[model samples]
Target chain A: MSEPNIYQPFLMRIDKITEEAPLVKTFKLVFVNDEEGKKFQFKAGQFGEYSVFGEGECTLCIASPPTRPGYIECTFRQAGRVTGALAGKEEGEIIGFRGPYGNTFPLEQWQGKNLLFIAGGIALPPLRCVIWNALDLRDRFKEITVIYGARSVADLVYKQELEEWAKRGDLKILTTVDPGGETPDWKGEIGFVPAVLEKADPICENTVALVCGPPIMIKLTLPVLAKLGFSPENTFTTLENRMKCGIGKCGHCMVGKYFVCKDGPVFTLAQLNQLPPEY
Target chain B: MIIEKKLLKQDSVEKLFAKLKADGRRILAPKAQGDEIFFEQVASASEMAKDYIQTTLSPKGAVFPRVEALFRYQMEGKDVKIENNSEPQPTVIFGLRPCDAASFAILNSVFSWDYQDSQFKSRLAQTAAITVSCSRADEYCFCTSVGGSPGDTKGSDILLTRIGSGDYLAEILTEKGKAMVTLAPELFAEAPSEDKEKYLAKVPVKFDLKKLTEKLPEAFNNNELWMEQSLRCLGCGACAFVCPACVCFDIQDESKRESGVRLRCWDSCGFSLFTAHTSGHNPRPVQSQRWRQRVMHKFSYFNDRQKYLGCVGCGRCSRKCPADMNLLEHLKAIAEAR
Candidate 1:
């Protein structure tokens, strides 16, 4: 292969776009070159720098699971300049993507153990990758519990996937909306994810908890997990930082000594405790 | 291995410039401009500033420019065309101080860490550095504290030390230096064995690097100290802009209706926007936190990750800081903290 140009992005066409929630959309991207698609490989919890041609790039996790190949999916809210441009784009439009960067969740280590997924609001996308990855390899895991929450009933992403997961008899899935967020007809739980998790009271033994959410949610839930007898070593969460150049060189995504884009985006609670809380 | 040494008459320095220019190499030399010295393209030796402690900016711009276009793209109907900028031309930077020269190596660790920055790589490959040893020291100079010296030859292709009023001892350290020598062989003569240190500057070590390294990590949570120290900081980013080792950058796209170019510009950790997330959350939310990041990144974090000190003890940041925030003073305070 020729020398790799670090900043040059691979062209990916948006095959489909889903309005997962208000202001949040999921883009199903396929590589413009079929050969590139075949070679592209990413594990759960890894992120990529996605760009609009005339706009800039932003870091987002590969929302789609690796078990399903041929295309990658990313869910982003219309927050900033790049995401606004990304939100404005239609299907069949070409955008730039570079990555499969950072370390992945140690899924093999969780084999034969129960898996608990805790996420909030737009943060579901990062955990969704790991959730589907474990579900696809169903035999390797025992009981799977998913606790997801959003600001309101309308704010939850992947509604179809939530319904499908709830219907599965093998897994226990609980969805929640914050207090005062539920509609009169809303049937799911009403409260925060951490509070709802405490009520569910899943067995902490032989289980790994994967949590992703807003920083506030993560800060609150981590303590609850400790109270519920989940070891810090077995609890993992991915960090989000403002980044340019998904590789390590750019230097903006650093949290303490660690480059969030390289050393992590994924870190266990045990690992996080050792690091400075700058993130 | 024995290194070759030669002498060049100070007056004949112009002849060396003539030869370098004739060979089609762009010569970047420190020149006196208004109140400060700046590294600018020079046509002749007389244009160079003869007396200056240090330039306003580091010579990093020669390799990693302030603004660089990665590629230009144009939309041709539904298809897009990309044209990468050409590689840099062979260039020579003359009169760079030893500390600034050493910074190139420190910066190399970051640029080539995981993703190779080809633009920076090509510029570094094509450029040759000629470092002049400091003959006088300033209060802000502390090269010795950070594993460097006034006459350190860590990153220079050629090391030049003034031996007398009109004579310089030239030690060619790299093949590029030897090639420059070959360009004008007659200008160089055999140097008599003499002590060159007599003419060099003496810079005192201000702080204990070993002690500071051990204490800096513990200082991360000392928010009150950081807040007190950074109270006067305006967050103008002057220190980072003038620093030789500060390598943070921002990438942007400039476009018209159908065409645009992706440009990378120098960024600073001192800026509040540096770590601001799109969701209106900032990891380093306060000036004190940002200040802590600068100190921790340089003295602790960078060493842990890159196996080298991010700072070269050039003291340019201290000199350029408008808030009078001195790195040496801060480091001393950090060392003295319980």
Candidate 2:
């Protein structure tokens, strides 16, 4: 064959396994081959097709930031066949990953602007890549703020990382839980993501907001952002569509004329408005 | 692309088949299977179906199989051993329609558009098409409406049109066809004064393709129209299964504890599971939306992205649809929709 197989994945060994939540785990995977590891590169917000050799592949974001190299991390909730198999894997186990697919967040455009990140529940992983990216290059941006919420305090992923971000002086992090989901010793806000975002009321001028969450959270949060004077172009989000070949060939990820794998997983609110609600 | 046409005596077809076999190529041709015709391996030209207007399934499987093993794997002590699927056997599609022949490029545009699927590429490289022009067409045939005709040669390495006097007018289209001619130099003769079109089937245009493509984007919001059109749809996927240009597939692995093979099998957009997320939230939840997607992808989305229409106007889909969901009628409805 003149060309190599596109579906063939790079073999990665699970370096570390962190139990982020009840059934969610973050796997820090390193390339099995040192040469492959040094050559590998990916940006924040791009996703991969994680494979459990016996099971099929699942589309998940590179939850880890690009600032750190040598390995990539993926945070997934044990929801499906592939994820269940992935969660069952122990550290040092081998897995397959065909990756860095789809588009990335244009962080260069957000430089010198306030970066506001709003995330809900399991959707936090995609945004966490950008949140850390912005934090790593803190001097490039003006103010960095994170308002992350979930169904409950127990359900929030990256618990240790959240505490670390909260301790950092360069950024402000506000964690929240749904009204009835808070514990007696809970220290964060008690409300849904939209309500919590509205209560904070951050300034919208020269600011770019990245929001990723459940459909309802997104639907409710968009209007709140608009109310706070955030324009459609200033707000960015990523879309996750069912994919087989994550490289635009498989017709599953098409949203109208655009392939979510090609045109974007990242799009402005204005771009989303032009597309049909297929995703 | 330049075309070199020649006339072959009626007796020369069987001789050419012998030559192809001698060239170490497996010939795939349409054969009768009960009532339906499907592409099957044949030893000689005489075994090929003579009266079929079109096969029940496309000859696309010659290049892209229904289920192809992408890789074979075995677990070692702590490492995994991977092996790419071996090269596909050289194949020659003996007698496919021009419409089905045209589907190869559309499929090629997809598999090679971004990341080259070498599995598909290798198969295509090893395959050559010898298309037989239609002498008769049925109600479902719409080759002309989609910029094709019974005599149109798009994807064939060699196009054979039956002229008067029971002879064949062969158009050597590619290097593969030239190579075949070299194998049996005596069979191909000087072109006869026979126009291939005179003997070809006349499939009148049913709907204006340009109008249909333009109207489809605007009509995408009309879910009620899709519902009405696809009311009888069972989502059986026979249409997509038989379609020449439907390239959607699902990757799966079947293992026997120690070893396994990863296969990419044919999948359809009409299936509910095609776009269902693991979270149980499906993007295309209803049948109407799926039907709409099938139409829109072929008419609008594919045209915009791939620079090629996804439908080949082969009519296998309309003929194989168990629901009797006539694609032509629906397309006409979409074209005429306000």
TM-scores for every predicted model? 0.97, 0.98
* Model 1: CAPRI class: medium
Scored by lDDT, model 2 comes in at 0.90
Per-residue C-alpha lDDT of model 2 across residues B157-251, encoded as one tens digit per residue: 89998887888899999998898899998999999877787899999999999889988878998878999998999988889999999999899
Of candidate 1 chain B, the 10-residue stretch with the lowest lDDT total is B1-10
Clashes of each: 0, 0
Regions of model 1 farther than 4 Å from truth:
none
Clash pairs for candidate 2: none
- List per-prediction Cα lDDT, in the order shown: 0.90, 0.90
For residues A136-212, what per-residue lDDT tens digits would candidate 1 score against the true structure? 99999999999999999999999999999999988899999999999999889999999999999989999999999
Scoring each candidate complex against the real one, what DockQ results? Answer: 0.61, 0.78
Candidate 2 residues lying further than 4 Å off, grouped into runs, are none
B190-250, model 1: which lDDT tens digit per residue?
9769867988999989888898999988788888989999999889899988888888999
Q: Model 2 over residues A20-81: C-alpha lDDT tens digits?
A: 98999999999999998999999888999999887878999999899989999999999999
Indicate which candidate wins on TM-score: 2
